[model samples]
Target: MNRSALTARGTPRRRMSVEQRREQIMDAARDLAVTEGFHAATLERIAQACGITKTLIYQQFGNLSGLLLAMVEREFARAAAGFTAARQRPPQPGQSGFAAGVAGVLEAVDAAPATWRMILLPSQGGPPELYERLDEARRLTREALVADLLAADPALASLTNPDHEAAIALLHAMSEELVRLRLSDPAAFTVERLLAQAEWLAKAMFGRRG
Candidate 1:
C-alpha cells in the first residue's frame, strides 16, 4: 500500500473524548469485575480490555485503585439513579403504589442486567470499599422503602401499634430476594411473572385491611 493509504488505514476511525474514554475504561473494568471477580480487574487487564495502554488509564483515574473505585462509584450511581427514577414515577391506575414500585424495580433490573448483577450478586474478593459502598446502598434503599411503605399505605402506618421496623425488614428482604432471583435466572424468573406474584402477595396481605 502507498504510504498515505497505509497511514490512513492505521489511524483510528474516530477519536474518543476524554470523558468518553474514561467511560469506556470504566465499562471494561466493570465487565471484568462482574465476569471474573474484582481481582481480575487490574490496570493491565483493563488496558487490554480497552485496547489502551496502562498509562492512559492512569491519566484518567490516577491508579488501579482509583480506576476501580471510580468505576464502582459510577456504576452504583447509575443503579441508584435508575431506582430513584423508578420510585419517582407515579403508580399506574388501580395499582397500589407498592406494586407500581415493584414493577419499576424489575424494569430497572431488566434495563441494566449487568449493573444489577454486580449489585445483586456481587463477586467475592472485591475491595473493602466495594463492600462498604454496597452496604451503604442497601441501607439507603431500605430506608427509602420504609418511607415509601409508610406513605403509600397510611392505614398500615397509622395502625394502633404496628411494628414498622420488622415489617420494613421483611419487605426489604423480599424485594432483595426477588431481585436476586431475577438476576440469577432471568428466563425462569421473568419480570412479568415476578411482578404478578408480588402484586398477588401484596393484595392478599392488604386486601382485608383496605
Candidate 2:
C-alpha cells in the first residue's frame, strides 16, 4: 500500500502529453528555425525554449532527425501556400497579377531569408528524404507563374507553340533565378532594380519573344 501510494504521488502530471507537446515544441522550433538559421537550431535549445525536457522531444518526435524532418515538411507547406499556390490566384488581372506574383516571392525571400537560405544552402548537410519537398513547392510555383502570365494577357494563349513544355521550363527557370538572386545578396540590389530586371526577363520570355 505504501509503495503504490509513494509511486503514484511521485509521478508527475504533464500539461500536455508527449504527442501534443511535441507539436508545440516543433512549432516553436519551426518559428525559431525560420527566424534563426537552421544551423543555429538545436534540440537542447529548442526544448529549453519550449520549457520542456529534452527527453520529451525525443519521445514525441523520435529523435533530432525525426523532428528535423517534421520541421522541414512544415516549412515546405508554408512555401506551397505562401509562394506557389498563392501565385496561382492573384486577385486581379493585367500587369498587376504578374507583378504581384513576382513581388510576393521577393517579399517572402526578404522577410524570411532563413527559410530561403535553407533551400539554397542547406545546413546539417540536409536530409535526403526532404529532397523533393522544396522542388514540389517550387515546381508548383513555376507552373502558377506560367498560368498567371497567360491569364494576365490572353494574347499569349493564341501565339504559342514551339513547345508547351518549354513554356513550363522557362517559367521554372525564371522563378528559380529570381529566387536565387533574391536570396544571394539582397542588400546589393534595390527593389526597383529587382522588379525592373524581373519584368525584363518576363518580357523577354512571354511578352514579345513568343
Candidate 3:
C-alpha cells in the first residue's frame, strides 16, 4: 500500500487536477446558486459543497464574484454558440434562419433550464453587479440578433431607421416572454405550439416573401 495515499483518518484523499478542481468548484457554485439563492451560494457554501477549503476556492477564482463572473462568461459563450449554430444550419423549407435561431435558443433552455434561468430569470436577491453584467450581455445579444434578422431577410434592412431600436427591443421582449412562458408552463407552451405561433406571427409581420 502507498503510505501517502491514505489520510490520517485512513480515508483516501481525492486529489483532482487543477482544471478538474476548478470545474468541481464552479459546478458546486452553479448548482447552489440555481437551486438556492445566489447569496446562499457563498464562498464557504461553495467550498463546502465541493469538499474543498474556502482558501482553495479563493486561490482558484480570487473571490466569489470572480467565480460568478466566470460562470456568466461560460454560459454566455454557450448561448452565443447555440445561436450561431442555429443560424448556420441549412435552412429548412419555409423556415427562416431567424425562426431557427429562436427555436435553437428555446431548445437550449430546455436542455439546460438551470443555466438559462441564471441569466433569464430575475435575480431577486442576487448582487446588483451580477444583474448589470447580465443586462449588458442581453443588450449585446439583442444587437446581434437584430443584425442576424437583417441578414436573414434583406427586406428587413429598410426597417433599420431611427425607430428600429424600438422594434428590436419589442421583438426581443416578445421572444423572451415566450421563452418565459415555455419555461414556466411546458404543458401550456409546448415547443411545437410555440413555434407554430411564432411562425404565424412572423408571417403576419413580414409576409411570405421567401
Q: What is the lDDT ranking, best to worst?
A: 1, 3, 2
- Candidate 1 clash total? 0
lDDT of 2 by residue, 76-142 (tens): 6666556764475454344445556767777777776656666655555456756677667667666
Best by TM-score: 1
Ranked by TM-score, the better of candidates 1 and 3 is 1
Models 1 onward score TM values of 0.88, 0.69, 0.80
lDDT of candidate 3?
Answer: 0.74
On lDDT, the candidate that comes out on top is: 1
Segments of candidate 3 deviating more than 4 angstroms: 1-14, 157-165, 208-210
lDDT, candidate 3, 1-210, per-residue tens: 586777898888668999998878877877787778787889889888886789998898899889987876766677667656655665569876556767877888788776777777745676676688778877877887788777786766444243556766776777777788887888999988887776765555555434
For model 2, give the 10-residue run with minimal summed lDDT. 89-98
Ranking by TM-score: 1, 3, 2
lDDT per residue as tens, model 1, 1-210? 345444455853566899999999999989998999888988889999888899999899899889888888888998999899878878878776667787888889889888888887889977778889999988998899878866887777554335668766777778788889998888999887887777775665455442
